[model samples]
Target: MSVKIILAGGGTGGHIFPAIAIANAIKKQQPDAEILFVGAKGRMEMEKVPQAGYEIKGIDIIGFNRSSLIKNIGLPFKLLRSFVQVRTIINQFKPDAVIGVGGYSSFPVLRFAQSKGIASFIHESNSFAGKANMMLGKKATKVFVASDGMEKFFPAQKIMITGNPVRASISLSSITKEEGLKYFGLETTKKTVLVVGGSLGAKSINEAIDAGLEEFEKNNLQLIWQTGKIYAEKAKTRAEGKFNVWVNEFISQMEHAYSAADVVISRAGAMAIAEICLVAKPAVFVPYPHAAEDHQTVNAKHLVEKHAGLMVKDNEAKEKLVSSIIALAKDEAKQNELKQHIAKLGVSDADTVIATEVLKLIKK
Candidate 1:
């Protein structure tokens, strides 16, 4: 019989895409391997996983509401119910291993699997780990972390630094810079800035661009702005035409955007940082301040401290994001320096490395 692996995690694309990549790796190693995904009901994973050609089961789960105490009243019941759901799913799937990629749903699935003495693995994508993954690290057979010095969060013996697995689109983008510009309907001669704040969008970054639209034109720069869902219409109305800007809710083909970009302004999420490094884009990160333990900032600081990138705090984004990126775009010297440094930090084959490691443990 082929090996059966259970994967869990996801609220955002950051967690879901990595989980899918690992699943694909396992499938490649053992074509007959049975893979299953567990995610929170109504979460992005519920839709994305199936689209990736894997089966996924949804559990009743949610995280604590830090901003609203009253919203957490149903927390205990939801958690308990999710555990019950996990138990049922695991018993039915009978997985040889469970892999978690850090999200609310991961807690229940891994916890239940650990209790049954089944092997469990964890992928901590952030430089600063989440509370759930830190707790799961104690018993997980292997813990895959994005950065080192994570002994503070997980068992030192179990931790393996694999870096974050980026999408194959970015890892294998062979399109030339000129072709990339053509893909975005922009001139190769004009300096271009790409703005991304993850799939849902970052208000601060969007507002920053909205505040500085005139400056970009004055600076003779073009923009390919991904305003996310929240500010799509708002940015569209604000940026309607003039032949120099492309504004949308999401850029479905991000590899092209990354390829076309001269400079990028974005949120400092782990996955975002990984892709930016892979593309070697000179960037200014505005960390999502509310991320657990301010990890977005921590992730950006890791690059900034190495002179690999720049950081503008969430509070400072509106005032500083556009101006900073514009400055870097105009200054070829600074852009080249940042590009060289950030490229040095890029781990382009992380997906293969992480997938290979997971298979190694199983093959043994």
Candidate 2:
């Protein structure tokens, strides 16, 4: 009998991509496995999953809005509706296992699956676990995590340190620096700073980089700036006639970006950190201060402590981000040190590890 699995998560590329990676790994190991993705309605996964050649079901789910209490007034209604939707999906898909990659959508689907006594798995990619994932971990058959010391969030015995799965295009890429530079229309002799603020863009990073465009040119450094969709127009206008900058809202080809980067400035989200590690680029992290429990900072701290990366606070970015990035760009020794240390943390085969374990549980 073919194994059926449900991969649930969304709201960001961080969650969506890892879920897809796991799905791909499972398909590779068990070609006959029927994989379905469940995500929040109107989220990126609805579009991205289909693009990845998988079927997806969307539930009417919304997370609590911590920034504004009034925005969450209807959250209870949405949650209730999502549970009903999850039940229908569960009844129809009848998955042998449900895997929850932390997101608002993961909760209802995994909760519904657990209630039905089906095996459920939780992948907590962050050092700081989400509240929903923590709650779901109680009954999860196995919990896959990116780093060590996740015992505080889940039952220690159920946890497996599988690392975060980076997309295959990046982790397995053979793209060279010269090819990457050509792809971005950049010169080989100039240092390239790849600025990314997650898939949605970081307003602070954008503003900081915009404020320092001249500094980059003065230092003979070039930029591959991903401004997210909201900042794209402004970033393009700002970089107009500037040969030192390449601005885009999203980078469709991240492998090229990784190859082109001499140093990276990024928000320290788990998936971003994972990709940076796999790419082995020295990075300056600007943790999103508003992330759940300031988890982004925790993710950055892990690297900083190990001398794998540097960090600037979100509030401090306007003054410090650009200078720090430029200084790091100029320092070859520090750059090489960060690169070698972070490379040790990279786990290129995490998808295979998680997939193999999931398949073993199914066979048992």
Candidate 3:
């Protein structure tokens, strides 16, 4: 019998990439599996999921506006409308299982699936579970988590410790440092620092790096900077005459960037941390201070406590992030120490693990 499934998530690369990884892994195991994706309308998943060759349906869904209650007036209506859409999709598709991968869309999809007594699963990629995921997890067939001790949020019996699924391009990348440098038109002899502020550029990190452009030259270093779309033009202008810097709004080839970097400065989102660990690179994390429940800080702290990575407060990034990354780049011993510790935490086959579990659940 053909296995039919629905994967839901999307707002950032963090949610979308892992969802895609799981989708790809399921297809690998069950070549005839029918998979569909549901995401919030006008979100990044609308574009990204299709690019990965999966058909995705975008419903009118938006997360709560935490900054402005006034803007949330129509939110209830949006939620109701999204639930209707979810019901229609579920009824038409009649999926054997529905998986929520963490996003606004996931909430409604999984909620409806559970209401109908269909098997529902969740992949909570963060160390701290989101309010929606915590609520849905009670009835979920399984709740896959990246970290241990997530029982406080989800039912203990249902929690499965499956690390965040990293994109296949990164986990299985064979790109050599020399090849990575050549791809970016940089010299292999110069140490490289890759700065990524997530899919949407981090304004503070961008400003800090902009202020420290000359420091790279002073230290004889090259840079591969992914500035996200918002800051691309200004970032490009800043790197205009600099031969040592390659600045872009987005990196379609992240594996190459990771391969070329001796050190990385990144926003400490769950997926970012997952990718950094799998790449086994020395890193300086600057957690986004405003993240829900300040989870990014918690994510970074876990690694720092284990000596797997170092962190700088988001507010302090301007004064500290670049300098910290530079110091790490120059300290070969510390870099190797971080590399080995982080590699120990890396889970290269999370997609397969999650896929296998899903199949097992379906069989039961």
Candidate 3 lDDT (Cα, 0 to 1) = 0.95
Q: Mind sharing the TM-score for model 2?
A: 0.99
Kindly list the per-residue Cα lDDT of model 2 for residues 240-346, writing each as its tens digit. 99998999999989999999999999999999999999999999999999999999999999999999999999999999999999999999999999999999999
In model 1, the worst 10-residue window by lDDT is 348-357
**lDDT on C-alpha atoms for all candidate structures:** 0.89, 0.95, 0.95
131-223 per-residue lDDT for model 3 (tens digits): 999999999999999999999999999999999999999999999999999999999899999999999889989999999999999999999
TM-score of each: 0.97, 0.99, 0.99
Residue 270 CA displacement from its true place in model 2, Å:
0.5
Residue 354 displacement in candidate 2 (angstroms) = 0.7
Candidate 2 residue-pair clash tally: 0
